[model samples]
Target: MDADVTDSAGTPADPDHRAGDTPQGRSQEEPGATDSTDGSEPVPQKDAPQDETPQGEATDADAPQGSGDEDKAESSDENKADREADGTGAQTWADHPKDGSASRRKRPWLRWAALGASFLVMISAGAGWWLYKKLDGNITTDTSAAAELKVYEKERPTPVVMDAQNILLIGSDSRSGDNRKYGRDDGGSQRSDTTILLHLAADRKSATAVSLPRDLMVEVPKCRTGDDKETREQFTQFNSAFELGGTACTIRTVERLTGIRIDHHMVVDFNGFKDMVDAVDGVEICLKEPIDDKDARLELPAGRQTLNGEEALGYVRARKTLGDGSDTERMERQQRFLGALVNKMQSNGVLLNPTRLYPVLDAATKSLTTDSGLDSLRDLYDLVRSMRDVPTDQVQFLTVPRQPYRQNVNRDELVQPDASELFKQLREDKPVAVVPADELKEKEKAQDEKPDDTGSDSESPTPTPTYSGSSAADDLCEQ
Candidate 1:
């Protein structure tokens, strides 16, 4: 008996294992092995059953285990190729590091914020343009004035210096249309209730407002009416030119009187004046006595008080009830009221607030009938901008010196040398000698108290010529 031979699994092994024979008792053969001297033919042994399944009849469980790993690797390679083809292989937001994600998240929000800001800017710009157009349209232009002025353009005086400006401001008392409620409405004749020649210095440091009395006797030149009717030239009241013609004739008369070129003119009617006063809320005025005037429709008690539009108009117009009843005294009152008004407008925060400013502008533009040069919004804006920085104290108001006419006490005549001197100074763009009323009083007091220095005949400093008027900085209500 051979030693009991067994396989590793304890199964019975082949009996001819040492003989190198097949299980069927045939000789075993190997590749390249030499055969023994016994003449037996070599035979091949049968292979063990393979684990593979038949073709086209295999299940997932029957597939080799390594095949599953190969399938998984192939799928991963295909996914990588798709990512690279889509150009998102390493740049996908989700795959980014923590810091990159934070920055990436902010990008969209920043873009949206910028877009929102741009939209707001566009809206604001559109609103501003609309507002400008609306304000611009409110102004009324007098084409007739331009046409009339052109006829006399050659006769008008030339400017003495550059950058000097003269503007004729006419307050028209037209009892027509809305103004009919204020005064007599005879046909449509309008007269200049107030005339002011505003001279702006070439250096822009000083401003002078010279008020012309309506009762001043002056030579009225030939002028054509609105209907092409021509009036013969005659000596008449200064404001009679406006009654005969309109703004053009009035400008011509002023030009002839002062020999100063009028660069522009503005005519404001009664109703418009009231609206302006109302827009600024009211102007403060002081009254020495109680006033109850039926002609002017003003009723107010004594003391400092704020006057409404109607009251203000009445206050300015009430001559007999408020003062010595002379037109001169009335003019002085008008100057004081205007000075207070200027002070109020400059110091009361009106220009700084849009809400307050718009109404004032609206009332002012609508109230004005301007010459062609200053008809447009841009022209008016430029004019106002140029003078916005002028100091209130430098804004001086004075009447052209006048006295009772030789023939009539009601009429006025310009004082000879003083009036000519004032006109020459204005025409030459020279500074007017104007000292504040209080300062002049103080100087007079000092002169009374001090002794004259007669021993040393030293030349005195040229005194700044003083005029009788009030500055815008002066307080009208002060005792």
Candidate 2:
């Protein structure tokens, strides 16, 4: 069924020449150019023809097979007549519909279905692009300078590699850019008020979160801040690393202290945590006693209570009412609540449901500043997916070991045995089993209450609160 077309020189047909007698076409030496078909060639007409031979009859040698020259001419005339019998007969492959069927033979519904499928694909692509842009727009990304960040393939005994997985978490009061409208004090004196070190087992089956005291004094490395305009470097509290340089410097300081490479880091401001809490409806906590801390504007009664955004923030941040008024208790409370929060987020299907997930993600994105490794939406998603099924007990919490610092009345020094082992476990990636004396006592008390052990439902001596509102109490229990 293939019709072979050739040019005047008997080669394949070229676009340069066709049936219409354009200037180029008329100049071409077609086989029929020498014979007269309509008397003589028409005189040159400005738009129609110029100096070119007239269309002519075929030669005897060029006639159809098994036919005389006269018969061949007659057949040619009849074919031309048949072509004109139909309407305009000019045709090309494109003239047939895309499915290789003629327009008359195509099914109307099939064409429409194909068009609808194409439209849906285009819409899906556009939505994916928009989502990427929206999420990407909110993140502040940092990648270690490829040339500046040293990479050592040689096996060296590094702290992070020596212990379980270590991750650093920072909570900032930063009010830069759009945050100014939120009425936060993110101006000149911004410090990482809350810092946590997360330790995961070598198998990554469990984790322990340890809080670092913001008020503790530590050797701070020099750092640069501001643009070229207001940049400065100084040594102060470890928390000052954020104010001086930023997350990069803060990461460097923690790495120097623990001798462990932080695999990831996250910072959330006041509003970010608040929005996340509100989106989740709130978190539940069991408080046996009431707390009233004026600095944090907290007031609550003893017993279990569900806290809203403001109350939860107050509970985590208040230091005045917590045990011995020390930062360590505050860290413990933060860890307890954080474990609860993770459980809540997982059970609530925050990751599985897009309708619920987007708001949380939006809040987190707005509040977050991270290293370049976690800059994108995809990167954050992958990290969440990895830790989604980690058991709650596996996510343990602890405090960095410290004791009274001789240099300051209000500061601390790293404790012996416990603190060193803690760092050692982190370096070795081992699990930590820490049982506070009071918690151990409570467990023993519950065991004693078994019906067989007590023999009676009668009352026993009232148990002293291992965690009472004594001088030992930290403000973390306030609300």
TM-score leader: 1
Residue-by-residue lDDT tens digits, candidate 1, 1-479: 01111111133336756664333211123321223436655333233234432223334575456645564454344445555666443222233245443355658888899999999999999998888888788889999988988888898888888898999999988888888888789997888999999999988888899999999999989999988999999999999999889989999999999999999898887777778789899998777889999999988999989998899889888886876898887877788888777778778877667777777778888878898888877898788767767888888989998999999988999998889889998999887756655776787789899997889778887565567787788787872
lDDT of 2 by residue, 1-479 (tens): 01111112133435776665333222333322432335677333233223222223233454456645444343334334544565323222233234432332447888789999999999999997897779777887655421122332122134445434566788875656644443465454566878988766666576667777776666655544545222344434567777776666676667666667777688778778877887888888867768998877789987877888788888888888866677777777777777677777877888788878888888889878776778899988877776677766556666676766777857766666656666666776755664554765687698688567456688887442222111111122344
lDDT score of residue 52 within candidate 1: 31
By TM-score, how accurate is candidate 2?
Answer: 0.62
Candidate 1 off by > 4 Å: 1-112, 435-462
Q: Return the TM-score for each candidate structure.
A: 0.75, 0.62
Candidate 2: stretches off by over 4 Å = 1-118, 143-165, 175-186, 225-237, 289-294, 299-302, 322-324, 440-479
lDDT of 2 at 237: 57
How many clashes in each candidate? 0, 20
Model 1, residue pairs in steric clash: none
Reference-based lDDT, residue 285, model 2: 80
